[model samples]
Target: MEVKVTSSTILPSPTSHHSDIPLTIFDRFAANIHIYVIYAFTPPTPSNADLISALSKTLVYFPTLTANLSTDCHGRPCVSVGGPHEDRGALVVEATVLSKLEDHLPLTPSPDLRLLHPDAENPKHLLQVQLNRFQCGGLVIGLTSHHRVADGRSMCAFTIAWGKILRGVPIDPLPFYDQPWLKPRNPPLVQFDHWGSEFIHLSPQSNEFIITRTDVDPSEITNLLLHFSPDFITKLKAQTNKLSTDKHTTFETLLGYLWRKMTIARQLDDEECTTLSVSVNGRRRLQPTVPPEFFGNLVLNAYPKAKAKALIEGGAATAAGIVREGLRFIGEDYFQSFIDFGEVYGDRDLVPCFEKDGNVLSPKIEVDGWLGLGFDEVNFGGGGKLCAFLPTWVPFEGLLIFSPSLSQSGGVDVFVSLLEKHAVTMREISHSLD
Candidate 1:
């Protein structure tokens, strides 16, 4: 299959926002990262011109995404909103793919799949989109948004708004972009001891704490899309609750189950410390809860650790309990303390260390839950609902994303990326779930 780039253009915001908006602590960390979301639709694809037109109008409310990324005198990242003639706009590309849309179903990370979205590292455009028209008359909408400007929820807001505009419908729960809502205390105080360990920052002792991009050979890794129907989730939840007196949430049960299975598959040392890092949305967890429509990064990582032997032997209940305990650390006070911690140490370069070589450096896994994100309802005019949704392959091993499946069958899709050998075992574990 071949993809040909047909046209490239810029779509500026319909209305001007602030001249310069300073990024929050959460935004600074993901300054160089870009989040990709691909949506596939059936034939009689929506008009590229119509989609672009709708996007232009949608930018009026989400102008921050159209702004260019810049650093202030303090060397901190900021969004620079340009004037009428400053050429501040998103990069829009139209391409033609010679393969059928179904051919790429359950997408994986590869050079071919990479062609679906804009360059991940490109800083010139805060938002980039690729409109791919397949030979089978199917449409694939690829979106790449700077992670510093918005989190997954924020991105969903943008797409939902664009879809509303295309369908000539009113957008509800309008977006809010004020950053002062999360301002740090006058005298920043650190309340959390584990903040330093979870976030990567500049250390006086060494530069190793700074996060950097690493490449992995696709052949050495395996990416799988596993589905868990609602029935299966209910059964798993029952099993977990039966093991422990406490009732386990579906998220905790699923995460615990996967962690246990992955550990067993890897066959790690019994005494080795294994950690699972779960992403927590802090929007509603904060004091005076942030607005549902607030656009930006409001997430924190919850790390739950246990010995491999204990985790495997304790079964799903123990693992799920550990996860529940980890989540307890993220509350109103914790989020406020985190913001203060960032203010005091915002200048430092904090990075996350992941396994680069074939060997596992640390026994760690990151699970990002994308459930209840409304990814399937994004319609781009003409009643075109998202048929499939998945992130292109990420090189990071042991990173799992739980997303809502597009089939609307009350199921969940677990996108797992692991070592080739471990992936083989994961497939077997998933098959056994049936």
Candidate 2:
């Protein structure tokens, strides 16, 4: 589908800048990557002007987004809300498609999806949005944001807040950035060793683990989306828990099943080790629970690994058990330890361990989930469910993302990025309970 650019404008935030905000320890580890999120609505969608008005109002609540990604005096990443003489704005692009959105139902991730959003690598603003209008009066909103500024949960809350503002609803328990709890203890208690798992030192004298990129043909990489029905999940849980009486959550069961299948599809050697980087949320697990509306990255990645032979032979049930335990390990103490590490280790040369992983993470898998996020309740566009929503094209392989199904209430939509051959093999065995 061809997209014609209509008009482009910068929408400035309406708020008084108090001061620049520093990135918390939780925010330091996020990669410097931007993602394009596409949300399409059918005909009778709101006018572009109306959407902009709502967005402007929403920005009043999240003024930090209008600012730029800047480094503080100590060269640490932080949100530059503004100084005495500085003011910034977000980028908004208006586009038009000559085809009806219904004709392109169930939109999948592809290079063309990038056309619906602003350039993915924009550095001027933390938040950028595009409004794509279809010939049939349908509308698709494309948004791109810097990953270092916020996490999935934060973005979801911002979206919901924008929706509420658009519908004339009060944003009860409004979003907040004042997190006094993140202050470091007087006597910083560094309980856990985070040298290798999360952060790696970047000092010249220290031997840092080097990351190498896999140079594979771009054409060989593909993104495959799969919809797992509710009934299939019920059977997967039953089959996975046959040996033990304990029931597992849908996430755990699916994580295990997907890991096993992906390993088999990759056809790894029996002795080769495979690792799954599970994203763990510390909001509720922290000592003083982080508020749901608190806007920032409050998460970490947990690693679960085993020899290929053991993982395959252990079956999804055993795999699920590994995943369960991996998540169980990241509790209040773990969060406090990471905070303590950041408190005492601040200003030291630091970088995320996973940042060096190359294009093809064959024996390694990275996962991010967006299930049960209440995104379905957003009614700003057409006063109904979004026609389509998913990640744009990603270059990495062995990456997994779980999203709530747009059409199925209790179902899941799995997004897999892998080598074309491996993707083909994974799809062939996607539905098997074994």
Candidate 3:
């Protein structure tokens, strides 16, 4: 359904949930991160004032939505989560608002991407919405969520449930929040292999600088995820073997191509190092395998590398082959080794391969039925027409996302964002499609 792009409304602060202690998984997740976003729309016919009130009641139905912060096992700061029943966690909603829909900002990159500051006196996050008031007075919504509590896929599920409650329909597929995958290993697998060092905090003496800066023309930094056809994917799986052949499917092949492209985009000297990494879910791979539904931070980082000079001189297919090899090395044994590192290091810092001056690229392939699971089904009082899964931060120097192309072509939506200097080079490489 086409959603009008402009309209306005005023949403007041939600009445606090009636609880004192931490309660459910939602409370725990929301407590750790101090950010979230809301994008919603009203019906074209405009629901009666009573209907709006009825729709808003869903907020209070799930008490876990509102939680309070407490401590954890160690003296370190942590969230005291509430039980599934209600009332037992930390709930700190930083930003919430309702307004008319208007012009949409492009999906490209931006220099002024929102920033999060723990020291900000007031909440640092921003909740913005542009409403399109239709002649019939209906509405369409768009939203962006911070990457702290949930990913785009999880947020989509939440939005759908909210809509179901607003429309007074049965909560179909009820919210599934099984996050057992991120738990510590049963016997505590421990090792230090390829992931021996990853994501290190800067030391005062280190010559490297750690800074995150956005570039100009927010739209210029488009996040793109190149997807291979199903036939291609099937063939790739057959041709590439993680155990021996230095070949990997879409993720590895694409990343290899991107690493070369990004290096060119950034114009790094031939001698400089280049890094490519992606997030691996540690759930099913964890020792004894956690429940599929379990959902906390069940992710591990993997980087397959190649030198700048090596990639640029090598053609795309050749470079891609190198990437495939790197990824093939990351089979089950590699994952198990990674778990060992986590068990040994726990939350301690590990030095990452991407040095301060290093040029890096990260590309991700979207799994099926991800954000689309319940996007259209979401409704508040007015109900929503159009909605988007927005990610506030790229985290790395450049991020490429591959999502199901929302349009009928079934092509995957590709989102790309990177530093301005690299934008030009990436644009050229993007045009060199296979």
Most accurate candidate by TM-score: 2
Model 2 per-residue lDDT tens digits across residues 266-292: 999999999999888888888778889
Worst 10 residues of 1 by lDDT: 353-362
Residue 300 displacement in candidate 3 (angstroms): 1.8
lDDT per residue (tens digit) for residues 1-434 in model 3: 23322233333224432323312222222223333222334345334343335434543433223333444455322333333323222212122123233333222222222321122223322222232233334343334333333444445555565565656677555544454333445676644444323434445654443534333454434443444455544454444343334445455555555566677777777777665555554444556664433323344445556667877786555666766554455555555655555555544434444442223333222122232334444456443444333343343446655444333234334455665566666766764644
- A best-first ranking of the candidates according to their lDDT comes to 2, 1, 3
TM-score of each: 0.91, 0.96, 0.60
Best by lDDT: 2
lDDT to native, each model: 0.78, 0.83, 0.43
Residue 304 deviation, candidate 2, in Å?
Answer: 1.2
Name model 1 segments beyond 4 Å from true. Answer: 15-18, 84-88, 106-111, 120-123, 200-203, 206-218, 347-362, 431-434
What lDDT score is found at residue 383 in candidate 1?
A: 53
* Candidate 1 lDDT over residue span 116-180, tens digit each: 77665453677989999988778988888878788888898889899999888988878988766
Candidate 3: stretches off by over 4 Å: 1-65, 68-70, 80-146, 167-187, 193-196, 199-250, 287-292, 321-396
